[model samples]
Target: MAYTTLGDTGLDVSRLCLGCMNFGSERSWMMNDRDASVDLIHEALDLGINFLDTANVYSTGESEEIVGDAVASANRDELVLATKVFGEMRDGPNGSGLSRKHILDQVEASLDRLGTDYIDLYQIHRWDDDTPIEETLAALDHLVETGRVRYIGASTMTAYQFTKALYTSDIEDYSRFACMQPEYSAVARHEEANLLEVCEAEGVGVIPWSPLAGGFLTGKYERDGDPTDGTRGAASESVRGYFIEENWDVLDEIRALAEAKGATPAQVALAWLLHREVVDAPIIGPRSSEHLRENVGAVSVDLSDEEAARIEAPKTPRWPAAGKD
Candidate 1:
């Protein structure tokens, strides 16, 4: 459980953040019951994981409720709790997006659901094209000023949008984005183009989601054969996009490296991210204790420079038009 300050902020968080997207009711395909979720939370805390990331849209807020109850017994001051706003939480035009109404309403709802007074990091799930960036930044600045949210972050936005938001915050003296939650993994390196570069240059911490590429990097799926039964990739449509030839090549490299290093493919995949200078933490959503333990082991799975380079040899150009010279 290596710890580091989140981006330029002094808030310390674990290298592996426990993602709570899989801790709700049966409504979610990978969800666990209340008792099971609580047990998992306890295991994570016992394993020295202080950072927990969740979103309001996960299980329609049931995940937050479960997380709130699960972490009730833990020392609150030592925990770094994060949740997201966006994704239609209800009906009507103001139900979602980064509008003032949506952010303000959702923050309170999230706080209530989490059983906490302040969120360590409150992130916008994605860019809201409908609302002006200024409006969203102002509302987020208010949350920091009012002490509802300690720090702010954004997820899955283009580098231009992220840069614009940061500039807006700088000129307006609002709370700047302290972190970025992008979709990055051994098989999905699209963010390597400009989003990661901007964050690295701007000192914004990168806490990537789906660091396993929706279980594609876990070595459970086969290139020429069927996916293992009951795996997320087997039943979910989300994994279909990553089931390409190029990613399979990347997975082969990862599998070979894992075998050579005596680590699981998941650990090797996570270790690859942990080895990156730009990434602060890779969020892991483990559905069981075994999965949790395996993910946590990634913290110690050190990768040599050669092994790291080999794992990423199959990366395609993130922005093909902006070809590298």
Candidate 2:
């Protein structure tokens, strides 16, 4: 397991972060039960993956509880435990968003659920248009000052919003965003238009989610037929969005490269991101121990520059608003 610093911080994290979205019993889509969740967590730790990411809203907080219990026996100092805020945790307006009330309330709740006194990295799940960025940054600054959160991060927002947040933090002398969690993969390189460059220039670490395009880049789905039954793409509309023809073409290239290199398509896809200088880690959510082990192998699947270009050559054009040819 290769390790790197989390963004600009000195904190060390694995190249692969174990996403805990698949843990918990409340969600039928999440296949892992308490015992299974514990076992997978152990498996991940055994494989040298120290970063574990969960959210306050995953399984309505049950995922955090399971993760908490799973890692209770591990050496806490060796792990980089992360969770997110800005999700509705309960009834009422105060339950969500990046409002001061929501962030403060959610962090405490997340800490309680994760069975940890301090979160290594606490991220805002998304942009909160309703809340003032000042209020949100100020509140996050307080968390870092109070030692409840060791670092702060943002996810899936535009470069403009991220830039504003960083500027606000600097001007106010508040805690700045140290990392970004974007949706990036061989099939989804939209972040390259601006977000990736911005992070690279600003020294913010990039940790992408859905590195396999929610299993689309795994080459398990057929181009001419419906997705396999019971898979995430088959059941969720968001995951199903990757079924476009262009992505299939990209997947074809990925498949060919994986075969030539004696690697699985998932490893090839992840390796593409791993080889990039800007990406700090790619979060991998596996429902089973077998999947976890397979994903871990991606760290060693080195990609030559030409092969990397082949995997990314079929990218669809970014939106017109990005202003790139």
After superposition, candidate 2 runs with Cα above 4 Å error: 320-325
lDDT of 2 by residue, 239-287 (tens): 7787777777788998998999899999999999998999999999888
Q: Which ten residues in a row have the lowest lDDT in candidate 1?
A: 316-325
Residue-level lDDT of model 1, residues 1-325, one tens digit each, is 8999999999999999999999887444666578988899999999999999999999899989988998888999999999999899888889889999999999999999999999999999999989999999999999999999999999998889999999999999999999999888887787888689999999999999999988888888887887766777778777867877778888898889889889999999999999999999999999889999999999999999999999888776474222110
Instruction: Report residue 124 deviation for candidate 2 (angstroms).
Output: 0.4
lDDT of each: 0.90, 0.87
Give the CA lDDT, 0 to 100, for residue 195 in model 2. 85
Clash-forming residue pairs, model 2: none
Span of ten consecutive residues with least summed lDDT in model 2: 316-325
Overall local distance difference test of candidate 2:
0.87
